[model samples]
Target: MTTPSTAGSLRSRAAESPVDCDVVVAGAGPAGLMLAGELRAGGASVIVLERLTEINPLLKAGTLNRPNIEAFYRRGLLPVLRQAQQETEWTVSYISSRRSDGTSTLPRFSGHFAAIMLSEELLDESDPDLAGLNPPDMVDLVHQKQVEAILADRAAGLGAEVRRGVEVTGFEQDAEGVTVTTGKGPIRCGWLVGCDGGRSTVRKLAGFDFPGTAPEITGYHGVADITGVQDLGVGWHATDTGVYLNDPPRGRITTVAFDGAPAGHDTPATAEDLQAAIRHVTGADATVTGITSLTRFTDNTRQATTYRQGRVLLAGDAAHVHPPFGGQGLNLSVGDAMNLGWKLAATVRGTAPDGLLDTYTAERHPLGAWVLNWTRAQIAVMRPEPHARALREVVADLARTVDGATYFAKKISGISQRYDLSGDNPLVGASAPDYELADGSRLADHMHDGRALLLDPTGARHDLVAPYRDRMRTITTAPLTDDAPAAMFIRPDGYVAWAGEPGRDSLDEALRTWLGAPVAYPSQTPDVVAAQR
Candidate 1:
């Protein structure tokens, strides 16, 4: 192992030389920082650049969906996030319709789609289809800043260098490496990843074609001192013109106006502007005395034509952008980072199999498109037109049903997210279940090191995995679940790469395909080594 001083010297030398590090990630948000930590855990040198000198306090995402929750648990960051969640206060309200008698009914579920309440009663907790889908506190409502802070701390602890106030202006990639031009200076790296926000300078400069639908409505969020208005109880309300939500604890007010008008880019929103939007959406005379902060958003959706362009790649909002209707934006971006981190690290370390890096695009593009389409579907039903209103009513009725509610719940929580991979077992492309072993260790407890896992419940695959011990971990334990197989190969991102009974030919192929060919041991003779090779 190299000493810290020696490592610093090597980095300094590399900085002055052609390449500065193995990977240079642009942006220091949750996606970028999470990727940085993952790459560092995978033994790759990473440099994360951020345009902002200081961390922003704004809370963009108020909740972490099921997928992100499991991801955090896998990384051992869930405990930290839960601690942060305790320190932060959030006002959450369930949205539903009012009865004719003026008494409001409680929603059957905690989430909504196009203002329709998704009923939790439809979800059978004991069903096999829902296995590994729900974790403790399935939906965590933590502030976005808190999440970023946790990720940044983890990345730094893992030895990733994060530099603030360094803006990436452009980049040029050749067959050898990429030369990134930033506001400070130029830095060369083996690969570049853009985790910038929606208005990604890297995406624009790198010439990635972003194609999607235009904005359908202008949305507003603000915190203002108000008076002379009847307290519209906390929750979402859909009117003839649009939708508005008010949660008094945080002095929060939100509105979605369907006039198809975009907010001015240069002009900052004021109290008067927010009041007008609220009045239009609620048909109530609300007075705004003072505004703390006001911002505007839109349903303008766009996705990169491809996630990768040679040695340069994109993740998070830089790769895809859509309206944060069901609060899928942050979750999607974090999932992108988790999925790309290990693959990119492998590529940088020269251990990636054929087409390994390309699989990033293959696996993520469709997921991005699915999210974009999901948001678009919500916008369609939320439209103020008569036809859309009629459709929304129909959807509301269906959402109250068992099947409709379960379907929407699955989609909203991301429990149904499964990558398309070649496998006969249904669990192959799904997230691995956190199985508890006889020794009291859980599956996630073994994944924090960011290495592939070969779980052998029967303890018969030790010989098969011994050759790749450096890159893979073999856990010997009894079957923990009724659906547990004799063996399972889990990737670094917690996705199952292969699963079956022991002594299958496909198992060896999967080992070589994902973890690369095994190294020969010193005990092997020359003829055996040559034959193995």
Candidate 2:
């Protein structure tokens, strides 16, 4: 908990510290801040409580997937994610594969969906550090602090109160609302959102159970602004010793294997140890300018069985913790907020029932599990044993030759992973591409505001959406004219809410699931008006 006046914002002093809001977000990290943004976008009254004196300088989650980018665009978040960049250059560092025998260098791939989706070209590993992602949104070069501050500003702009240095000590909640006890003291609110970190005080006070296995093996990772050391590709550089680098061309970020590190302890990781490991992996002593940030974490893959308990609920790390192998923590946190904020806002705004909040945990908990399972498999394949290497080789060869790199690529990039329930089509619950509309327009252009968008066929009835204009944005079907194109059925989070041919029945069904009811587009042509009548 920090004092209000000094948490790097004099702007707070100009305005009164809010005692309460509809939603109170603890922890000013990306997760907390992004949740705040989503709540604000949905017109929810929000208050963000951060104990930090300032924002974090480290760039934590290094990448965001295509699905995430699409989500951002649909939700009107790409502007914030990209800021000023026109295009972003994603880095494709080194890759490694190990089985029972020995470790060998595997081919590198870009986290940028364009390279993976359009070209299959692996860029230099250091691309994202200097440039941004494709379209400059998902893979922008904003530090954790910068992104946090950006969201904080957005929250404030959207009428949400953001209080820094106000440490949230605890909370008391009932059927109605919540009263939060902060370092700044007690404040009352209609709802409290615990966006606090893995060791959340809010979760503890609420007695929310974080049910999952804590990894016996831990991993240590550090980021240093170093000079020298070229591309290692993007993947693990496994020794019988155990190491996996989020490797970049300029300076790869390497981590000790889960088995390599001591169990249960998150401490004892230092610059000296990281540099030594770097030396071993690169086979050279590179220039170590300084450590931007360092963290030693036990891989704990856990999620609260329920995200909400009464008026108080949890989001981000407060609700779940898993290995960072997928770079999903930040995205997952945003997803949590994206899932919950709108639903919570609708409830608060008197449009939806409180029961909708339960779906937040339902949708996201399993997504985290998939990431957990995949990372575990990746860790197993990287194990430094002859037996493990042999087992991995047989599968890896089969996957590549048979299943192909595209499948492997999708898995690693999170493109292949779909949700538990995708409405009717498999593509519905999956990520939507930055596709072209039927009219040769970009899907993003139609998502001017944060609303569910339906990509209707050129002649399909747009009148169906016109009725729910406030809740839905409708676009005409168009073929891909350029590299970037419009897509069909965009959830607020930018996932393909629905796919295939868009019709009256299909569009209405999608609206019901995503927006809670039937929606109508604003543009009502004379023909559409006649048809409705």
Instruction: Identify the leading candidate in terms of lDDT.
Output: 1
Model 1 lDDT tens row, 1-533: 11222434544655666688889999999889989998998888999999999787654788888778888888878678867766664422321233443223654454889866666767666656666564543337687788899999999999999999999988888766789999889998878999998998889988999999998788888777877556685777788889877768778888999887564745766777888888889887889998876777889899999998888899999999998889889899999998989888876665667677788888888989999999999999999889999999899988887777777888888888988888887789999888877776678877777888888766666667777766777777664567788788999999999988776688888877776667677642211110000
Runs off by more than 4 Å, candidate 2? 1-19, 77-108, 111-146, 225-235, 244-249, 257-269, 275-290, 395-402, 420-427, 432-435, 438-440, 456-467, 476-490, 496-533
True-structure RMSD, every candidate: 6.7, 9.7
Model 1 global lDDT (CA atoms, 0 to 1): 0.80
Residue range 401-489, candidate 2, lDDT tens digits: 42344455455555555666556565667655555445445656665456666655464655566655565666555545443222366
Cα TM-score per model: 0.90, 0.74
As a whole number from 0 to 100, the lDDT of residue 439 in candidate 1 is 70
Query: RMSD in Å for candidate 2, one decimal?
Result: 9.7
- Measured with C-alpha atoms, the lDDT of residue 285 in candidate 2 is 63
